[model samples]
Target: MKDRLSAFYWLHETQFAQISSNLITSQRRKAIDIFETEGFPTVRNEDWKYTSLKKLIAPNYVLPSPFASFDEEEQVEYKDIKKFLVNDIDCYQVVFINGRYSSWLSQTTHSKYDICTLGSAWKKYPKIVEENFNKLTKDDGPLVQLNTALAWEGLYVNVPKNIVVEKPIQVLYFTTGSTPVFNQTRSLVILAEGSSAEIIERHHSLTNHETWTNAVDEIQIGSNSSIHWVKLQHDSPQASLTQHSKINQEKDSKAIVHTISTGGKFIRNNLDFSLSGPGAEAHMFGLTLGNDRQLVDHHTRVDHIAPNCSSHETYKGIYDDYSKGVFNGKIYVHTDAQKTAAYQQNNNLILSEKASIDTKPQLEIYADDVKCSHGCTVGQLDEDALFYLRARGIRLKEAKALLMLAFANDAISDIQHPSLRVKLSQLIGRKLGVDMSTVL
Candidate 1:
């Protein structure tokens, strides 16, 4: 807490004005005040009891310069970062280097739709940023507040009404610097009525420098619209990440969010969905593969505010070595939300004796006519299945990997994009030390 406070004080004194302008000055100040009053969440906070930021916050991380220009000698080639992209897929790409937009490496469009950076939108279309910025974010968390106060560069996408984007949009953030640094980024996505789009967001570190990223995303789906949002976190082991996503759905709209976390030393994800109108639906899925001493925590909430709304959530984790995992999910059916249907499930597999997992699924229903259920399971590999596979030609490592793949396929099958599913499957196989190229 002291370290965080000291860093905040230093940033407030040195860099606050540089990051804020007349349009966002007041909002930044309010956010900074909130962070100062609330501080970092501790075990006393019910929502964060299973996860702690003591180690992540202990370092006195230097805030990266927002407008720092890279020299010609420091420029990164596309070939160096192309391996992290989905090479088989044709999509619009937006790349950010060290918290700044890389126009030379980005392919964006402003014709039928708006696909650009927050900085561009703020400068060119101030009204759009003014109308949507900070509207969906909750002011209850300190990390989010800090992001609100300091976020400068990220993706901004707006899909017009009745238009179906044939291609997905890929937004990638890469960090490259000699010194350990901290960064804050925000993304805003708005889908108009009857529109549909797919978006993929990822974070990667090119250097081994210790880094911390605080990211926030706000998504609003209009009536009869749909969105498929996926987040991939595969940074270096020295990196730490904290992300929050708030999604709002209108009448007859649909939202699907898939989070895959396979890297980073420490990661915490907060995902929330609000079904604000009748017939709205939300589907949430997550897969986390943690090894070594890494820690991955996911906290999710689905609020059914209107009648005839529904939500489905499933999360699976595989922990190896001395890694730890946490899953906390809640379903809230309001008093007026009759005929609400909500279901949640969390499962985990601990591969080593030292690996651990903590899971809690809660349901709060105020309407008597709602149907809500939640269940969780935690155990080791199925010995019977392992033996069955080993009895065949499969080796022990291959058998274990096959079992884990089968376990994660439950969520992987939900992916709507074929190339993305295959890419994720290959990454998962590599993480498990198995060759899945032929199987996938």
Candidate 2:
């Protein structure tokens, strides 16, 4: 695979090599070397066993440039903006059209925190980007390298020490243009010591044309800090989306990530957490609602390198039609990480006879005193529960919907914000045709 370089190969390679040339050190050069040796992961790789990148490799997409800006009415389709008015968020909003940032649509307003787009940030704060931009993640992965080489517009967020952001920071990425435009956006988030904030990163497609969005986010949480990261992916069904996020946590720091995927023909999420400090905690959570022939794959890995660290992950999926879902979760505890605690579980509900799911939950602990457990369960709705609800005067459809809602309620209730949680629950109920939002 590494030797096979099609016409599109040069398109990505030139950009990556040029970017590496801008850096003084040999780190970026080494990454390019690794990328050349080990192209994209195939089915043979355990990490990419279920999800295939064939479509991404087959249709060679063009790197998008700065396109037209969204109108006020069209902007409402994004999550952060309310019409033309900006909501009171912890950090500023960075708007991206196609795959590039729009300076006209973006404002320089900052909270008590620091915020800037990657393009503007690189010009103003080259030291920060040089010091940390690609430090936390690896470029060995083909898509990672591809994103690095072709990254056009990105967001850079920095939280001050000991300050708790009062509101959530939202970043809106909109995809437009025709001809399977390729969107490779990168984001860097730095949480200072003892700081806390909630971040909402969303991917939305305005047009129904064929588009591909490949995004990469690198987050670093300082000592005693906390970050709540929410990823809401709703792209066009004709689009293909791939997102990868790598989070590094320090001592006493806590990072919580939740992902909700409902759109796109082929969706794959690679969420990795590295606990580098003792007493650090990490939580990985996800929910996916897939129908038709859509495919959604979630692969997560949490590595506990320090002593007394903890981690927990739970993901649930509901599939209908001939849709397929995949969940692969692994918890790894180093030998020296004494007293480590880790737990992982995945549960999937299949709605149709043709719907299928593949789940694998594993724990690899070298420490003898650590406590770790992992498991996965795949099944259909409970007929007994449905019958019981129907016997109590509820309709069959209503009973099934109610049970499904109950199964997903735990995850929805875990959301810290009340209004958002309620809204999501109601929407879920509506999707299931329960119409029991009033009671919920």
Candidate 3:
């Protein structure tokens, strides 16, 4: 895998030279060098102790080209992917097919605020791109460095001051599945002061062929602004994803992120938060449904660097059919970050005896005046509650489904989008082999 990546980089390195600025090109060069030096992570690495990249990287995947052209006779349209969209809610779309922008499937803008591709933004909005691009990620790993070195075209969103985007932005990335391919994507979102936005992002594969996606997102929240980011991970069983998201918040800003994972061969999410401004708050909620031999992990860190900042994190999982799950959350408070309030919890239910979960929650505080708590629980469904529901005339399958539904809803109850919540309920029910659309 290392040699393949090395050769691919030197061969396809010129694909980014035309679209990227000098700063970006320099960063790409340094990142590729670092990745080549370190190579893909292994279980020996402390950060990836529980997860293994051996199975994911052994496929000899082919790298995607930036100029890979689709056949003009077979173009993608909204009608082709209607089942993937939230049918009830209105949204602005940004679609990527095979790591390239698809204009026909995307509804973007330039007048109200820039919600377009980084390929154009690098040429049009150079200042904003230079200021926030690659600025949020300081602690880089091998996979992240790989993305930085190769990914060029992705979603670019910048909302100016005092503006509220009425419609939610739906960002979708799709794989054609014509061949086993490996791709990287980068997204940068900047919300100025007094502005707020809601976004829904998802990845899907049209075919069950092997696809590996390494994605990174950098979000900057200005003073008194808020951004809600919801990521729905329901891909084919052959698909694998490794996503790293970094969020930086300023004074009185709020950052909300949700990761709902149900289907994927192997999935890992890294969420990092930096509360650098006083009065800033960060909220994280995640729900993962694991079945079969799938693996899903969510590793999060929240750093309290300013005084009077607060953060809340909650993640829950339900596993069955020999699946495995992991959750590791850490909260750090600096000495100068007095009056910090931080709370974190991870809860999981293993329905099958062969299934398992590993959860670790940690908190480190140096401030004199701070409130911090961390806890985790791994258990099974309450037999008494299940029996009671069954005794009330509900079928056993429905009863178990209801219990799981109640358990998962707490993490996403505050999504603020009714249609999305309903759609999620449908997805959850389908995954559980029950009908729960009307229950939500």
- For all predictions, the C-alpha RMSD in Å is 2.1, 3.8, 1.4
Q: Residue 159's C-alpha lDDT in candidate 1?
A: 90
Models 1 onward score TM values of: 0.95, 0.88, 0.97
Q: Model 1 misses residue 400 by how many Å?
A: 0.5
Q: What is the C-alpha local distance difference test score of each model?
A: 0.86, 0.75, 0.88
List, in order, the clash count of every candidate structure: 0, 0, 0
Q: Which one wins by TM-score: 1 or 2?
A: 1
Model 2: per-residue Cα lDDT over 203-283, one tens digit each: 766666667788888898999999998777655687778888899999999998888776678888989888999999998
Question: Which segments of model 2 are wrong by more than 4 Å?
Answer: 1-21, 24-33, 66-92, 103-108, 433-436
- Global CA lDDT computed for model 1: 0.86
For candidate 1, the TM-score is 0.95
- Lowest summed lDDT across 10 adjacent residues in model 1 is found at 65-74
- State the lDDT of candidate 1 residue by residue for 28-82, as single tens digits: 7777778878888898998788788877877666565564555443367799789
Rank by TM-score (best first): 3, 1, 2
Error of 2 at 45 (Å): 2.0
lDDT of 3 by residue, 334-384 (tens): 999999999998999999998888888877888999999888888888899
